[model samples]
Target: MFYQFPEDFYWGGASSALQTEGSDSSRGKTIFDVFYNLAPNRFFDGVGPNKLADFYHRYKEDISLYKAVGHNSHRTSISWARLIPDGDGDVDQEAVVYYHEVIDEFKRQGVTLIMNLMHFDMPAALQAKGGFENREVVDAYVRYAKICFELFGDKVKLWATFNEPIVTPEGGYLYDFHYPNVVDFKRAVQVSYNMIIAHAAAVKVFHQVVDGGEICTILNITPIYPRSDNPKDVAAARIADLIFVRSFLDPVLLGQWNAELVEFLGEHDLLPVGLPEDKQLIAANRVDFIGLNYYQPRRVKAKEHVPHPESVLLPESFFDYYEMQGRRMNTSRGWEIYPKAIYDMLMTIKNEYGNVKCYIAENGMGIQQEDQFRGADGVIDDTYRIAFYKEHLRYVHQAISEGVNCFGYHIWTPIDNWSMINAYKNRYGVIEFNPQTGERKLKRSGSWFKELVDANGFDD
Candidate 1:
């Protein structure tokens, strides 16, 4: 079988400022580093995002690698602290030069750049002022996004206002996975509401200034399904989906907040205060595109137990995760393998959200293997990775045929980048990196990707 992509189909990879660019540059300190610094071991494996794939110094060589590996496009984010050393006022000249060089170098290699303005990297200075909880922070983001658009708008055509805006509130406020770890539902709702406002502000600036630039919001949209055909289970799945995906999607894409979400929050008295002008501002600037980062689907069902003060609580305390029977799993990261999730996500977008153009902004498998790539004939054979990507692409091809309107596909990362708390424990790169000596090496899957890019499809 041969599944060929369109002529304009994009072949590229993704990296984040916080994840790939080491924090040692004049980028200053982000809230991520500051929070974990307050308590180092609070993160997974006791390491923060400081120890990253030092792309700060190696971007020249890395950009060259991206070109050599057959990339027509690449996605990367700019650290807020890096640009504004104070997070609000003066911009850093040294940081500006570095990023310009990186962006220019990519352009020289004939690669289109998709620049994300913020990717969970809040400047420590901004975090000092209550982060996303403050409306002042929203104003700061609009100014910052404007600066980026004015500076890089000519070269970069695509801009992302925020990456997975809900994840920060969910992980930091609701769940205990991220910093300022709190278990308050009201604060989570507040933070989420403010982030949406911030996103709308950025999009408004993008449309007003940048003549040809398009701004979109990136989301880690997970599809939720019920355990059985039971009515309660099905209803729970719909509510969870609303809270997770549509909560942000509706406001940004459809130019209005989800009425159901507002009604639900109003029932709990969790709605944030906003004026009539604020409502107009949000409804004016709708997104031109979407960036979908799909790795796993969420399988949920109605919760069996009632909430108690002593219970381990989360935002989704009303639902229970029901692992599908006989489902395949990524043993390395323990994520369920559900290829159909991507297809369903595309169809859902088309059916519910007007089939807006989108791209698979991030998709990759993470493993725990390190220093295990020895060659039989001078080549490390990573067949499992090759298979992992192929299976996903097949599904994407199916989506394309079904008129999903996806423009491109980007793997989660180009090189082995850092995770917030996981440190270097997980491997999710086509290009493997050596943490011991800061060496960069392409795995067998990297070569396979080059072939896939050259062919513009997969044949099996």
Candidate 2:
């Protein structure tokens, strides 16, 4: 086989409490539950988070399937609202028991657990108190992280402070897809700054409480591609990369801020206000490792027009999106299918970022109406999904061969689960979670993944 992974490399999938755990009655309300409750019609098919893969109740069976599919590790999340009920105050013993049961079952199945602290499911109680925008919320998050580390650190092999922390500021404050929707760039910068503080403080907590487990932060990096060879277009891509990529990446991995980003935000008068202590806290609390998630590449061109006087300035005010002609795309989600972006990103980390230990935390293909591909033999023959995995994994192996300090490869998920606004409009899992029948059946891609796991690679 031309594509082979290391002997002890992790091979499995990733899931979040918001997407997989079902029946919102047992846990405290998340902002997602509140948003879906307010406007179900805004989501696809009017389905809310109450519709999920039922991992809360069926995690044993789910773990068994994970082992059956030849998994050695799985990255999952612990719900703050589930574990603590509120952001602070009291702890829920019942939720603690449930998580212990789930973690024990994963151990029995010989699957290593990589637990994440937050996955966009902020407790509604905290949201009511200004979420991450307030310094009080940062302290509360550190408390939550300390509890999680002390309670479950013995069993969990690795810890991640936040999964794609940038998405919260981008989706909730910049865009309106998430709850507490506000489009103020100033507030978004504040929220983003506070999250960095929270993450750094959480990393400090993880080290103090946990004995030896390393902590990381997962980032979804979409490589920005310039429209042409012109210096203006290249400069636009650089700005976009600083905003979307470096804003989170630099602080978490390098323990410093990008001076250019600071200058840009200062010029716009959008810099976040913080205390004197935050700079040192962020610099001293760099992560033990990193997790990189990639799905698509973004194309950008130099701005063609100046913003109107009445319009609010945004990151898009500097760069315009360009859809390249003849580029491959995933028609279901309208995402570009440029798998080689993974290799490029890995190389960048090697050359510029000190080659910190990292892994492919997520990479997957989502297609609409997967039932259309179901075969008569009671399996979904998702060859396109298979092709997606093959191409992406090939780049991963190539990067590994070039000595990129990369380890492990986990897909977006093993079973289809609840997505915020989209619900289950697009399926990205190898194991089919049938919402109609409430049963999970292995897709053809699942079997192919098992082969990949067993061989630790693929044949040319």
TM-score of each: 0.97, 0.99
Give the Cα-based TM-score of candidate 2 against the true structure: 0.99
Model 1 root mean square deviation, Cα atoms: 1.6
TM-score computed on alpha carbons, candidate 1: 0.97
Write down the lDDT that model 2 would get: 0.90
Query: What CA RMSD would you report for each candidate?
Result: 1.6, 0.9
Tens digits of per-residue lDDT, candidate 2, 1-460, equal 5687999999999999989998567799899888988888889998898888889999999998887777899999999999887888688888889999999999988999999999999999999999999889888999999988888988885999889998998999998889988888899999999999999999988888888889999999778899998999999999999999999999988898899999999999999999998889999999988999999998999999987878877889999999999999999998999999999989888888999999999999989999999999989999999899999989999999999999899998899887889989999999999887889989999999999899999886
lDDT: which candidate is best?
A: 2
- Candidate 1 weakest lDDT stretch, 10 residues: 370-379
Best by TM-score: 2
lDDT for position 460 in model 1: 81
Clashing pairs in 2: none
Instruction: State each model's CA lDDT, in order.
Output: 0.85, 0.90
For model 1, the stretches where C-alpha displacement exceeds 4 angstroms are 309-313, 377-379
